[model samples]
Target: MEQIALKAEKRDISKKGTINELRRKGKLPGVLYGKNIESSPVAVDAKELLKVLKTHGESALINLELEGEKHPVLMKEIQRDTLKDAIVHVDFYRVSMTDRIEFNLPLVLKGDAEGVRMGGILQHQKRELSVKALPADMPEHLEVDISGLKIGDTLTVGDLKMDEKITVLDDPEEVVISILAPKLAEDTEVPTGEQAAEPEVVAKGKEKQEEE
Candidate 1:
């Protein structure tokens, strides 16, 4: 849990157009708040924010500097424009390093599963794990080794090895990943020429009986 420094400035929330203009100016519109502090509208350099996100990921602990005051914050939500694939707004939640906080940590799968190499399908059921821990004890992500997995094997949250300081909040029985047996292609049966002509012969026999 390395904390990265970010600078922000207080912004006017009275006008929505001002926020759009801020984005046009390459400033990311965001808000900072905590359990004890009031929600404050702020803006930061969009490029700088992107750099931090690229380097440290969304789970990175951020030391937000606003008006000469520093706030230890976590990125709570990021609103993006789907059509343009651009980030529109972001929410920063302030945190206390000493207090236990709950957040979703990313799960990373490492190594190729033996089952997959043997023509089995590998399914990743859970991508993130819910955890509660002190900010200082938080990990960037959890890694799981899948090389030992065989067909029909499953890995659950209970199987995860983590620090004692971090408490997993998700159900222990929840499956994280599993190796399934390979799907077999269905065999298609083609009708022989006589089989296909049987219906026509039956119809002709019924026609002759009706005439008689």
Candidate 2:
């Protein structure tokens, strides 16, 4: 994974109202925590963080530079403003290159499925895969080829090919994608004028019997 540099400053204010004031000045509140490291509250430039998010997405490795010290980190979570779709707060997890990390990588379909071209429906069952690997061995996304898939065929987790350094944490039998055969439209039986005619009504307890 590619790493981008981000600068953060130690935050002294912890109140919600004070954080809102910091945001008004183009600062975003965030926390950094990791194994064997002290958790610290910090603030980052909103514009710079937005740029990183746009270029690297959520899974990118970040080089967080704070107080003249550099820490390799990953974005764990981001709180956003629901109405404006803007980032409100962020969480960062410090990481080491030699340590194994679990990441949810997106699955990208590489080719058009043969079944889809043949009028079959292509169903994507899994959008992401949980994988554990060294930080340096992590991938931005996993590519799944679907060109060879035929109708009624399914691609499972076991079918995926990955680097030996990475291990998938999901079930091998789990389906990732499948091509379903096209459904045949059912025929509706319409009533003709004679068949639509109402039958003659009989009084209660009185009914006509069929003659032999």
Candidate 3:
């Protein structure tokens, strides 16, 4: 994974009121901690942080600045305002250049499957795979090639290979993606008109029986 050099400074003041004030001033409230480091409250811009997320995605390495020092970090988690799409809280984990960090790497499918070319549909069961690796050795994502897959062919975890430094957390037998024949897809939705007409037909049949 490509690690970009980004820095955020510590915030001297912190409180609910201060956070609200900070957001009003176009800043985001967050904290940086983990490993052998003390927790530091920090504030950054909402727009800039979002840009970093969009550019680097989940495989981002954040470099936090405190008192002229740079802390190599990763975004561990984030809390957001669901309605407004605003970031409410952020968690940053400090990582060592030598130690391995566990992260859920996204799975990217490359090359159209031969099955799909033959009118088959590709189904993906997992979007991300958990793995542990050194920060410098972390993969941005695992790419699975599906070029030769035919209809009913499934790509499972066992078919995946990774660098020696990376350890996949999921079971090797788990299915990741599969090519399904279009005819095999079953429609499970009920027909609204059929459902609405069934009761009237039953009522009419009962009325006819009573009259007879």
RMSD of each: 3.2, 5.0, 4.5
Q: What local lDDT does model 1 show for residue 36?
A: 92
Per-residue error (Å), model 1, residue 208: 12
Across residues 160-198, which tens digit of lDDT does each residue of candidate 3 receive?
Answer: 878888998899999999999887333755567787699
For residues 32-59, write the lDDT of model 1, one tens digit per residue.
9998999999999999999988988898
Per lDDT, the best of the predicted structures is 1
Judge candidate 3 at residue 25 and give its lDDT: 84
Better of 2 and 3 by lDDT: 2
Per-candidate TM vs. native?
0.86, 0.84, 0.83
lDDT of 2 by residue, 10-62 (tens): 89764568787888899999999998899999999999999988776788889
Worst 10 residues of 3 by lDDT: 183-192
lDDT per prediction?
0.93, 0.89, 0.83
Pick by TM-score: which candidate is best? 1
Q: Supply the TM-score for candidate 1.
A: 0.86
Off by over 4 Å in 3: 13-16, 184-212
